[model samples]
Target: MTPVQPRTRLLFPLRRRATALAAVLLTACGDSSTGTGQPKSTLDQAVQAMGGAEALQAVTNEVVEASGSRQSPEQGSSISTPRHLSNFRYIRTDELDGDKLHIEHDHVTTYLSPERYQFTEVVNGASGFVDGKDTVFTPAQTSGMFTSRATAELGHTRLTSPLRVLRKALANPAIVQEEQDLEVDQHRFKVLVFREEGEPELRLLIDPETFLPAAARVLEDQPPLGDTVVEAWFSDYRDVSGVKYPYHLRITLDGVEAHAEDRERIMVNVSVPAQSYEVPASFQPPAQPVVPALADFGKRSTQLLQGLKYLTQTFFYFDQSGLPITLNELAPGVVHVVGPSHHSLLVEMKDYLVLVDTPLFYPERSEATLAAIKAKYPGKPIRYVIASHFHSDHIGGIRHFVADGGVTVLAGEPSVPFYQRAFSNPHTLVPDRLARNPVPVTVEGVKTLKVLDDGVHSVEAHRIQSIHSNDMVIVYLPKEKVLFVADLFNPNLFPSNQPAPYVWGVASGGLYDEIQRLGLDVERIAGGHGSGTGTMEVLRITGAR
Candidate 1:
């Protein structure tokens, strides 16, 4: 197979203006006061600004009604243009005593097609439920017995509310300290740092004159962009029931806008219904075993590929754990590289190997898989790496393969520019192989279908339309009569007897329609995720539903 070079230059210079500006700001705002005097005084002033400590203590519950838009940076069709969920209406209710939160979210997303998603999430103490059903927590979230994924997310959400932050800090004064001041857009902000146990360090920026929280900043460890700064800016403060609340909130990830909201109503000490936090009687918990506690909390393990612990708090769907990598032979030349959560398939060609979907959230998994492939295959090199889609989990390790020297990436036509831009971005925070050894990457776009035939074996790459993503690609092996896909249908999750879940039914139905359109003989089906490969019968049963 001949590699197709990009029409334009692929390797562009990395942009460092933001990094330079941040460094200059940090230098200018060096710590001036170290003692507890500044922190205590600032806390007192902030409490007075927010209707005094009495008012804050009297608040037991809060209800906020807002409208906004949220961006899925990882699930975008392209790295540059993330999947945007606009026209979002949210009703969030919080019970401060038990650290309980219930949120109802309604939004519409348009990538290839317009689809509407409406769901309710609840977190009560140690248990979490979604739409009144028990939900599975990621390995990182279930690492500790005292804390769960839901509670961690609740804390992150509460950071946007200054009242909640002040209450928590006041309750534990030892954790609050005065940090260096910050200057942004000619405005200086007094920074109050909170170092809590088993939580990410939060830097709350306060307005010097108004003493209200101007913004909240925390460092989150995200793949492709490590140690990313997540900031939430607050504005338009309004007083309600003797308490001050911010009506406008804008959240940013690494200086890029992620979510923006404007409050329509705010209520304090509101009555919360019991059913909001209750799990349904028919709800069945996942059979997966509980994850063990880490040696150090909130720190990444150097020995293991387990992702950063705080990722669960930042990203709701983030889940990376240390699972043993196992290889299974599916066909005479096809091998399945299975990880704890995600999986990858390797197809042997005439001279080299073709890998389908580098499935994981980090390069470590890809690196490990590469080592395993080299060990098993001996001298064969990976010539082509096919990306199932532009989702972060599936493509996070693609850059690693590019750094391996002679691998051409195959992606959907719409995602070609996205891969180019993502490959050029500076990975200074945690330099991976690609960052350390810069190299030009060749990304070939598959408009509808692209076939690789080498007499002995042939692999076909086809772009399919799905509600899950616009840039969806599935691989077909006609000689073996096997189809490889991602996200569309996971047979293990949705068995042949069982019907596809709510939104998943739409995605699987689209896949079924595309299969019928192509008129290819498909016998076995493999997924980028899940445990085992399924049959065409399973796809028919689930997709037909």
Candidate 2:
């Protein structure tokens, strides 16, 4: 038997970027320090306060470890819910090895700067398969490595390692502003702001008395999201080998408190291994599908899933060797538009036409399917669309029907809430029919049965208690002795190598049950995923492999 696959959303393990760690750590720029400046300028004062440029530049290596709960971007309606909030801890080791700023993270990833050395995953116990080996993992592309590298440079330089930030500032002498007015903690103060081309806009609130950094703020683009704010407050100043640093740190995002870190010890002039940040040779990413990068896992996974929907539509829409959409005339005023993956039945009525279960895998497929339906029956519009269920594959192209003004979605009562969420959510990224042309989410929900008859043909939708999708809507045609079911029945039944989980296997779980109970005549079983016409007798007697 074919493997009973899990839901599409739970198939792949969703990945995470710095997320909680990314924004929180950039704020802890080693507390505040006092120093002398002839002009007492913002840059000079901050430089002196941070143990002087000579003291910071004189340092070699550093390391830090932090633990926090990361919010999952996928949970809430408006986003911002941690996927698994278990308070996972992580140890991050940073080093400047041979003109390269290197970093190793736990549960995250590693990076080697200057010339990005790539590694899908490099941790000793981490998991990833790359280059046909389990030891060292690498993605098909090495862009993630560069992303990690840039993040590390900003984090380590600004927070724990001050020299890197100072180095960049000195390199670009005009990047820092002298004096600016700012209010913090209900007090007015003079501030020094650092601006860069692509990097986050940094601001350092200065204490006029000691010329030390009171707090820091960074405005960064967390992909797929607009620029977000990251702020850090440093306190508990202590001297570490003649260099003062903040032992206590507080970080926040968008004015909401995120997380904090308390330093156990601050160690400078540490020894880093020769192979500490070693990575695989440079990789040249081959041209491939354009995948989107987002601020959080929610958007990334959503985008990827949507991308798969489009890909599925394209593959079936342009199958060169596959069968063309055959228009089967089962009876007068009754036809089925059969395609490679699925089929749709068209029943012409007196004034309008009724289309059963639009196999809307993609907008492309919908366009093709709707076009064929339109071509077959010239003038009449598909006034009512019977959506079998709320499966992604079945619903991806649902917008096509909604765009046809006054098209009512006839669904089961169980699927009303789902259709509501689907219709209301913002599709700003990829505007569809509902997004472009707004419409009231109209669904003629079938509590027990909903009959759409126009004097000539009648399309009856009966709610079935199917094992596959509990809220299954079986579209029955009494005159033609034909029925259209969504996932409950696969008209293209195959002989499996092993026994199927159900008595009927992948054919139909509750189809015969509903048919026998209702005593309706079902000669031909038309399916949403039917390859061609199927008979109910052959379906049951085929027997489980």
- The numbered model that scores best in lDDT is 1
- The true-versus-predicted C-alpha distance at residue 359 of model 2, in Å, is 3.5
Sequence-dependent TM-score of model 1: 0.66
Clashing residue pairs in candidate 2, if any? 1-498, 33-49, 71-82, 72-81, 72-82, 72-83, 223-295
Q: What overall lDDT goes with each candidate model?
A: 0.68, 0.51
The CA lDDT at 511 in model 1 is: 87
lDDT of 1: 0.68
lDDT of 1 by residue, 262-361 (tens): 9999999987778777644333233322222321212221101111111121232334444478888889998878877778889988899999987665
lDDT per residue as tens, model 2, 1-545: 11111121211012311111122111223333234412345666567666776776666666555544322221111122212212323343444322344433222211100112222222111111122111112323333222222333334246433334554576677887744355455554556667766444567666655656666766432221223355566777767665567666665544444445566665677776755554443321232211212112222122222122112121221212224667788789888777776667778888887777655434456767777777878888777777776554565566666666667778777666555545555544345555677666476667888987766787888987764454568889887788877656566554423322342364353466577788888888776764666776655544331
Q: Work out the TM-score per prediction.
A: 0.66, 0.49
For model 1 the local lDDT of residue 443 reads 81
Go through the candidates in order and give the C-alpha RMSD of each one to the true structure: 8.1, 12.9
